[model samples]
Target: MARVLEVQGVSKRFLGLKALQGVTLHLEEGEILAVIGPNGAGKSTLLNVISGLLRPDAGRVLFLGRDVTPLPPEARTHLGLGRAFQIPTPLPELTVRENLLVGALFGRPGRSRKEAEAMVEAVLELTGLAAKAEAPAGELTLLEDKRLELARALATGPKVLLLDEVMAGLRPKEAQEAVDLVRRIRDAGVSVLFIEHLMPVVRALADRVVVLDYGEVIAEGPYEQVAREERVREAYLGRRA
Candidate 1:
């Protein structure tokens, strides 16, 4: 399988704080890769760098083999990198379908209104939001909000999707539904790189896992294999005194 996304020796700093240091990872075509870590482990920072929300202090971000380190978020999206935030914040005034239309139209430059509407309809169906397409975004339940967030990103017609803890606040059942939805997304040809705090979600969805600690990668491999690593254990649970 070809690599869809790559982060080479990426690092970031916020004043004196090192948010990430020489972090490296890759997402393969049609694969679901999860980035996991304890708090302050630079997982979010890495996602920001990959999605073009923040420029790394050093290193490169490659999307479909093209260096996109200098591109802005919209440019990256246009280049087939789409992202869904950890928090679902849809526009309250607009209907759910309209919210997705915004993404489809603007996510890729030069997309026509007809093309955007068609994309929105497809996303609405894929995300199980077609029934509520005309409902106000603010009136959605938690699960609906989450679906809208994921749907909006999908409307961009991304080759690789970057999801930032989209399963964070869901119940176990709801998360399972999300896991299934993501699988369908992948089957539809989107490679996924997601940040997840829910271990079960990672175990259920990720084909591979990357663990970050102290702003650096501590382990990378199959979920069960990485789960048993001593370093990974220490990252989440303090070492025995």
Candidate 2:
């Protein structure tokens, strides 16, 4: 598969605090690349930079061979880039289906509302939310909310999905279900770059892993290679990687 997302020599700073330092990474099309790092390791910062929520101080972001460092999040989304948050955000005033409709409408770059609605229905079923189509978005359970977040992003019809710790704070079974959902998403040919602290999930779902520490990539490769790296083990033990 071709490279779908690329971060080269990326750096970000806030006043005197350096949030990221020369961070470079790439996400291939239709692959799951799990990013694991301890607190203060700039994992979330990387996501924000890629999604255009935060501008990096230096370096470039390329999508489909196009320079997108300056593009806004919506522009990127229109080009098949999508992101999910640690906390799912849904419109309390809207029905679950309505929320999905919004995604469907936006997912297609220049598609019509009717087309978006048709697409939304398909996405709802894929995200396992078809049964709650008429339910109020505000009434969803935690699992449903997380699924909704993913559903919203999927509604954008992305080829690449950036997830930020969406698996945290769940029971073992719930976590397993969430992991299964992610795998299913990947199976549908959407590349995933997920920021997760849970090693088991990372091990189970990711074909590759990227380990970051102090804003720089400390290790990158297959799960076993990265998990067994001395530096990775040290980094994990250093700040709980």
Candidate 3:
């Protein structure tokens, strides 16, 4: 499969603290990649750089073989990068469908209102939000809110989706459902790069796993392989005395 997204030698710093150091990773077409790490491993910072929310101190972001390091978040969205926050904050006044319509219309430049609405409908069905389409976004239960977050990002027509701990607050059953939904998203032609703290979710969904420590990649491979690495274990659990 083609490499749809690439972060080469990326680095970020904040007020004299190194948030990321020469981090490099890639997402292939139709692949699901997971980024796992201890707290302050720079996962969020990496996502921000990729999504164009932050300018890296060094390195470049490439999407579809084009350099996009200079693009803004909305510009990157227009170019097929979609993102869902860990927290779901839907517009209180808007209906579920309306919230999705917002993503569809603004995410892709030049998408007509008719086309945007069509995309919204497709996303609602894909994310299983059709039943609650007319309901106010603020009224959704936790699971429904999570679905809406994923649905809104999907409505943007992304070639690659960036997920930040989307499974954070779910129960086991709900997380399993979300795992299935993510698989369907990949099957539907969107490559996924997600940060997840749940090892089960990573093992279930990731084609490859990348481990980070102190903002640097310590290991990268299949889930089980990376899980057994001494460095990874030590990263999660402090080194032996």
Candidate 4:
């Protein structure tokens, strides 16, 4: 598949500190790329820059072969990029159906109310939220909340989905389910770029892994290859010897 998102030599600065330094990466159409890094590695910063939440001090972002680094967040969303937050936040007072409606209304490919509702209903079912549509958003369990967050992002009609730590707070079984949901998202033809700390989940879900440490890519490859790298293991975990 062709490249759907390209980030080249991206950098960001705060005060005198650099959060990212000449980071470059991209995602292929319908591929799942797992990004793993220790804290403060600028993983989230990279995601933000690609999604248009943070502007890069240097470099450019291209979406489907077009420069989009100058575009706003909403414009990116409108152009088939969507993201779920690391922390889940839904409208507590809104019913699952109603909250989903908001995503559908704002993120759908439609220009009218009827189109929005139809799109929302389709995604609600796809994300397994249809059964709980009438349930209040505040009434959901942790896993359910995570799924809802993903569902909302999908409702925005994104072809490239950026997921940050969706499996962070779930139980092992719940984590598996969340992983399954992401697989479904990819199977539906959307590309996935996920940031995660769980080694097993990354091993299971990612076609390839990208390792970041102190804001630079230390390694990139299949899970086993990366996990076996001496320097990568040392960077993430102190060497046994």
Using all chains and alpha carbons, the TM-scores for the candidates as numbered come to 0.97, 0.96, 0.97, 0.95
lDDT of each: 0.94, 0.89, 0.94, 0.88
Off by over 4 Å in 2: none
lDDT string, candidate 4, 29-119, tens digits = 9999999888778899999999999999999999989999999988899888989989878999999888877877777455487777887
Q: Candidate 1 — what's its lDDT?
A: 0.94
lDDT of 2 by residue, 39-158 (tens): 889999999999999999999999888999999888999998889988888898899999988887876677888888887888887878999999999999988888888889988888
For all predictions, the C-alpha RMSD in Å is: 1.4, 1.4, 1.5, 1.8
Best by the lDDT measure: 3
Return the clash pairs for model 3, or none.
none
Residue 11 lDDT in model 1?
94
Q: Order the candidate numbers by lDDT, best to worst.
A: 3, 1, 2, 4
lDDT of 1 at 77: 93
Which regions of candidate 1 deviate over 4 angstroms?
239-241
Error of 3 at 33 (Å): 0.3
Residue-level lDDT of model 3, residues 190-227, one tens digit each, is 99999999899999999999998989999999999999
Better of 2 and 4 by TM-score: 2
